[model samples]
Target: MAATLLFLFVFLSLYGSASCRLLQTPLLDHATTDPIDATQLPTSVEASPAQVQEVANVSRRELGYYTTSCETGNPIDDCWRCNANWESNRKKLAECAIGFGRDAVGGRDGEYYIVTDASDDDPVSPKPGTLRHAVIQSEPLWIIFDSDMNIVLKEELLMNSYKTIDGRGHEVHISHGPCITVQFVSNIIIHGIHVHDCKPAGNAMVRSSPTHYGYRTISDGDGISLFGARDVWVDHVSFARCTDGLFDAIMGSTAITVSNSFFTQHDKVMLLSHSDDYMADKTMQATIAFNHFGEGLVQRMPRCRHGFFEIVNNDYTHWEMYAIGGSADPTINSRGNRYTAPTNPFAKDVTMRMDTPESQWQSWDWHSEGDLFVNGAFFIPSGAGASSNYGKAASIGPKSSSLVGTMTANAGVLMCKAGSPC
Candidate 1:
């Protein structure tokens, strides 16, 4: 254990002078949190002691860690967002994620870095109390907006490790500019922000952190881009009219959860892998749960590549094209979601195996269990049921798809007022 701690100290020292802060994290102690095993959280479909830890017995109200009276929300919303005292205990939101990203504590342990300034005037040396500056700091921090504001980024916001952008208690919109970029970092949480109209801006020098500077290429107008990152959770954000995907996780990123959020007015809503041949993505694992895929969405409600994804309990109310699509050999286990198809009859099929011959793609593991389909919606399951691949039955699992409407009724950035449950 001493040797392991010493190695961690040396490893963090190479990044910057944040070794002291890094050492304080109990998860990094190696003994308590295994990096490889951290991503292996219990799926909704798996029901066995050996399959995954049954934490469902832990009530949503009990796990919220709220200080004051908690409002009665649906089981999922009651986890963190419905508490009247959420702002006082905002850091507790980090504990809300389940599945693969259950362990992403975000910057809960660090000091709060309140964003008093909304302008992203300079990326290289962002002003103190700015969102850009807060993200680049070496120490873990929970970033929050001081007031209701809309921030137009001068450049793409590059995020560092161990950070949480908690946008509760204030209306915050990151729109009409370059959006977020998470690259080669880990343990981040982005909640309760409006992300839209992200125009591309790059091809110049930018500072990703306080200790480093680098030249960056032209960025795609992605709402949130995660590259080579780990343990990320993006929840309760409203995405609309993005130049590219609402959220895209690529390049060996793993241990992620996109839940309790909302997506609308976007093409290619999400892309899990950048390349079909990027073999490193084979190890990727993500959980998509309790979100509302709302109006004006076209395709790729996560067109994925090689990865194991447990998609659960989301409400898909609109789609011009297919709801979920993929190429490469991906494992998609869709469970307990409510898919409400649009009027277009041709785009009714939920599965789209892009660029692959039906004969070849037929063998991929794609299973939809307990999903509620309406308006002629259907999921074309392929492969040998993908049942055994899901490990085991989950006796305590996702709630009924009938309850999805109430479960995700408050989907997206919510109206939060003081002295009231948000």
Candidate 2:
């Protein structure tokens, strides 16, 4: 353990200095200063239990040494996590986002809405102070919980626009019920909540806004569903045992970011597109960064379709099947990530081009750069002609994979106190 920790320190010191530019599409230019055309890319290049332990060991060293100050080399967390008055200045978090969802100012211009009630007895006329009521309000709100509570929704909790459901400084669990759904909304941020064991519920009237109530069909029982939504961010949330996808962003949802979260005991962890035929999804763009995909997981750590995706600087510790899978020619740029392949020999490949023949999917631009693999894991890259443009793109680059262990040390729901740094 000591040797591993020492090696990790040396590794970060060597490789952590450079910042790699995030990959971007022609539609989303805000995330990049020098964008590369998706049609041109590099060709194939083939590229762990001790690696997982090394992450934990480095995390332990970080916690033991930095008691007064917090520095995990995670750019988002480093922005506001060190402030002792984070509870009072909670809105500062809204400014710390990076990647494609960098402009998601979720309720930063609104007032605070404290959730004091946990009951979901009615989805239409929800009780004041309940989470359901707060989300349904049409006005922008920064929602926070008054106490630790487990909310079992009577139906899928539909959200309105410009809302930040901040769950820091409390243990808030929304489980054993239908979870959250963001349909046709914009600028939503969900953070620091434990969501699991979600079951499908619908076929009844549900209120999406304060003045409107409408009947809904059966929901897919995802922990969080983003349909036709934009500028959304889900951070520091722990997900497990959801009935369908733990997180599904479909139907033209774009500019989304999922960071600093943990996933376990699930199949089809994330789905990024509506379907193979959804042409409007060509505008979809997302960033999956600084997250930890932990034990007892299967495939599709995002199965994507027509979109541009930046999968960077995350820690993948376990997977029964492949870690990243996609179809329909999505542009996937996987860089500065750490993947520890499971013991199963057949599932050693980290990337899977599902349901597409190599003759067709060979042209898909899936590039892997500066990724670390353990336990005989390898990635199959596919693309057309190469380019030097990747070297010139400018942005807040992803940190080195060497620091991924400590960067994602505190992935899931954070334990935050009222007057202390979270």
Candidate 3:
């Protein structure tokens, strides 16, 4: 067949011109709430397991399994929402990131800030059009917000590195008090905001750049709290009640990507490890795409502990307890999701080996290929280990759970308008 389609187009053009060579690494060297500050953000970098299997084979050949068709068939929102000039190419949404955070180049090499003061009073001298002073500026930015606002932080809003808060066409809301604290530097990109009721502010002074400031403590209220972060990306955001965990990547966060977000009432709706013997979270790597786990969630749509995770095409209508859980040996790889099961009959099993004990987590690998399970939902997979560790949890390569409800139907925070075609 034409030499297997020219060897799959020369192996996806050398895996999209491979590149991810971080080295000068170091993490978890302090920050038990900033002792003397040096909360390790010296340009952090830690990606080796053969560079996370070559960035999970270049995010499974660029977020795999799409059979064409644009305008919301959701290939990262058709790579730019059919832009009628997406608010003047708002940094083209940082090149429409794909799995394994496709090198989150947020702030795409710097510029545009905006924000226009939404008041936080002072997390240590933050005042310029606030949002904590466009996330403690140092350089690269792309902030944008000037309209609908509601930011409310009295602490914990520390962020730095290449940024990109870009709350598309306004309606931004970093709710009820302290939230957002991506520690350690990295290319970050939190888009279209609406992070819910997060409380638990810090114990005092904060500020993460524009010449550092410190002295913090007491902060567990996560609405987005990735510590020791790496290239990250959270798109189309929205979350509900969160006194903790509405997205919590831990101590050794890796190339992450929480896409088309939207979570509900919440009770630990997301938490990618940093415990079970920290061990640098075994070089974490995430990619929970097209999210939507709506209405009163309870478990951890993401409760992983150790490493790789790539729950794809998400949409679990609701959950009361189990919708995907884990412990130390993490390596989940659920694909093309669509769970929907919660009449409580003991939470119809959607996997939760939390306190691990299936004779040692049945070897812990946990894979599920084209998921769908409606109503009496079920999924209890485990250990499908080597295919080279399932190619590092197969970053992404499934798109047929009946198209995951039109690719998560506008998953969240997308009310774009500036000449149409959002």
Over 4 Å off, model 1: 1-76, 392-396
Candidates ranked, most accurate by TM-score first: 2, 1, 3
lDDT of 1 at 258: 85
Candidate 2 achieves a global lDDT of: 0.81
lDDT of 3 by residue, 234-302 (tens): 998988897888889888989999998878888888889778999898878888987878878889998
Q: Find the candidate with the highest TM-score and give its number.
A: 2
Quantify all predictions' global Cα lDDT against the true fold: 0.76, 0.81, 0.75
TM-score of 1: 0.82
For residues 160-250, write the lDDT of model 2, one tens digit per residue.
9999999999899999999999999999999999999999998999999988999999999999999999999999999999999999999
Off by over 4 Å in 2: 1-69, 385-396
Candidate 2 versus the native: TM-score? 0.86
Which is the better candidate, 1 or 2, if ranked by TM-score? 2
What TM-score, over all chains together, does every model reach?
0.82, 0.86, 0.34
